[model samples]
Target: MSHASPAPAGITRRQALSAGAALCAGAPASAARRKPNLLFIHTDQHFAGAIAAHGCADVHTPNIDRLIARGVTFHESYSANPVCCPARTAWYTGRCTSESGVVQNDRFPIEPAMPDLGQWFGARGYDALYAGKWHVTGRDFTPSFRVLSHGHGLGEHGDATVARAAREYLRSRRRTDKPFFLSLGFLQPHDICYWVFAHTEPLAALPYPDLARELPPLWPNHGFDAREPETFRKNWRMGRIRQNMERWEEWQWRYYRWSYYRHVEMVDAHIGTVLDALAESGHDRDTAIIFTADHGDGMGAHQLWQKMYFYEEAARVPFVVSWPGELEAGKQDRAHLVSGLDVAPTLCDLAGIEAPPDCRGRSLAPLLRRKPVEWRDYLVSEAATTGRMVRTAGHKFIKYQGDGTEQLFDMRADRGEMHNLAAEGSSAGVAADHRKLLKEWEAHLSPSPAGRLTGTWDG
Candidate 1:
């Protein structure tokens, strides 16, 4: 197919042939009630706190703000595993890090039997197409998606190419009876990691001293709870950048934040183009847009530089689901706790298909459809090898294997997580409950047959 209307730009085996061919016998009659197309747009290292619409005053996100206005934004959603490969694996396979063997970035391969959304959807008659980043470790995007653009290394270079390709696809896509599942993996705000690397060493003076007044102030959690588990403390002091980050002057940290917000704005502009293209193509109403990130950047929170930590800055991400005129708009869902694990299940539910077997995440379709459903009371996120975080309605509990040192905080009163309530006698009951929940979660997992998770176990 030729894409000329504009730039806007995965396959799966067992997926060699089009499922649409099999459905042709029944497709003609159902042309009037066609399936809703799915547009799954994800970003890297973008936090909920970075968007202007999400109450952050740091940057202008007219595009994301508009998306929020057209959709339901979940303020409390989080990454399943606060790292690129693991979180994305959870998203595509609906499995936990342990189950997929992608315990960390570029570390391990996925279970062979696991089917990504592309393969699963394609088999069910959806045209599975992809553009931009596909960072699911060991699995080729070609096996699951029809590639649009492979995308560039840096968000500065790749994001525009991705946006243009997406715009072209939306504007000029061949109209088909079967719905299309287009997943656009954008690299952005994540580019701030490169910025951090460039400035690892302390500077004698601020690069733009005049802009000091404009740079955002350090996060309230800039000073973290020092009594962290070995998993977290080691992560803080792991690399040269992290070890040296603390010595950075207030201006330097603020400068880091100033640069991070710009990365957010950079992707926001491209997102705007994609949104405009969808509307211009007249598929805006019949399509559902699920926007989120694989994980979030530290943004200097806890004086941390990158991911692999369960700090709110790294774990928490923006999740917005929109289907214009079909669901409620401009609704902020701060009530339910959500996670990246929910991505696959929700998509399947919306398409009237049974969710993949043993899928760990709950579908938010009930909530989106205004159906009364029992919501999850807690959400879990993993970091590194042994780090585990269990977040309940009012508190967050963090622990690491073989580390007696644990941290707990009453999220309602101490959202900054500076205060440690784990050792306090008064909060022992809350801490115990959290421990039980984590144990139960671990018990339910049927871990991968081989790969990195094996080393994570100690008996």
Candidate 2:
């Protein structure tokens, strides 16, 4: 298939095809049976453990749980970046934030030369439509997708409006003959940011009512680690911690947790609306649905509030892939390490299209099909420009470029990441191994000149 016009300034069709070729080599033979429509449902700042299916008992996400019931849940999923723009950019381009030139929120636009998810799929005869937040860049979504709705900025009800637009499109506009790639980016739980901002001032705490019983309890890792790396300590101070955490008392923190979960529930309701629309439209069975988030909020873990930290609360996110009867259902794959970078290539692989050669993500098609395949031993996630994390099966290692500080956690024994084993004599060999792995991983990244210096993990 020919492109609609010349490839953008930096992107070449040859490079795109090369990426696709590498991806296609591993796709299942059954992928040729039929092309499935793609329904990508993305949310903002949703923690991986927030959903009941993922073992969170506090939050109610029936709609998202429905997807989990019908799909494969990746228990160990990390974002490409802990910030918004970079993480979403990773999903769109199948490349890491550094490679895609969007390492931080609003700091860099997606390189025009990069072929986004919509453009790549659209060129392959799919109708790519997008609704809600397109935070990677500005309002120009022409080449990537036909914008159905860009919600009103910073308003609480915008997510509902975004869902309504997506529902309408799924019901009336989708072309049946050609496959469609519909991306629904909902903004909700992110509103907790506003809540945090509003509470920053010294406001009197409201009396705790019996209704407070509904709120989630403080996470076990709520206390700050005295031995935490200096970089992370500095980040906590630099982030909303001083403005948000320092002022709040224990009950206030619990209230904050309560508010965050409510916001998640709010978005889950919007998600249910879209899921109902898809089912009513009679296209539910044939469409491959993916549910994920850009990144996760801290949810009071380790006295943190928002993303851009390497802690599990901020870096990990929910990832579910569902294609009824075609892929494995109701199975949780906790053994494999997956990243947000894999979304685009996985979608392309499912659709039997070639992902761009420049993409760094590997397709999850084999895992979905329950086929035995060689997967990565570890995964890397970036926190804007400074922090880099590498997670193996048992341990997680984090290094920040700013102060050369480090953190290491044995995920199996310390799931809450309360202990930093990086400085311990007993864990020295493990830390060294992870550092070597990160060094090797860094060697493969193709960051732009500016991004290269913006804290690419050199050690």
Among the numbered candidates, top TM-score falls to 2
Candidate 1 local lDDT, 110-173, one digit each (tens):
8878889999999988989888988888899897888889998899999999999988877777
> Model-by-model lDDT, in order?
0.79, 0.79
- Stretches of candidate 2 off by over 4 Å are 1-32, 173-175, 207-210, 238-244, 456-459
lDDT of 2 by residue, 229-274 (tens): 6666676765554765676777777888888888899999999999
TM-score of each: 0.91, 0.92
Candidate 2 residue 449 C-alpha distance from true site, Å: 2.2
Model 2 poorest 10 in a row by lDDT: 1-10
Instruction: For candidate 1, give the lDDT.
Output: 0.79
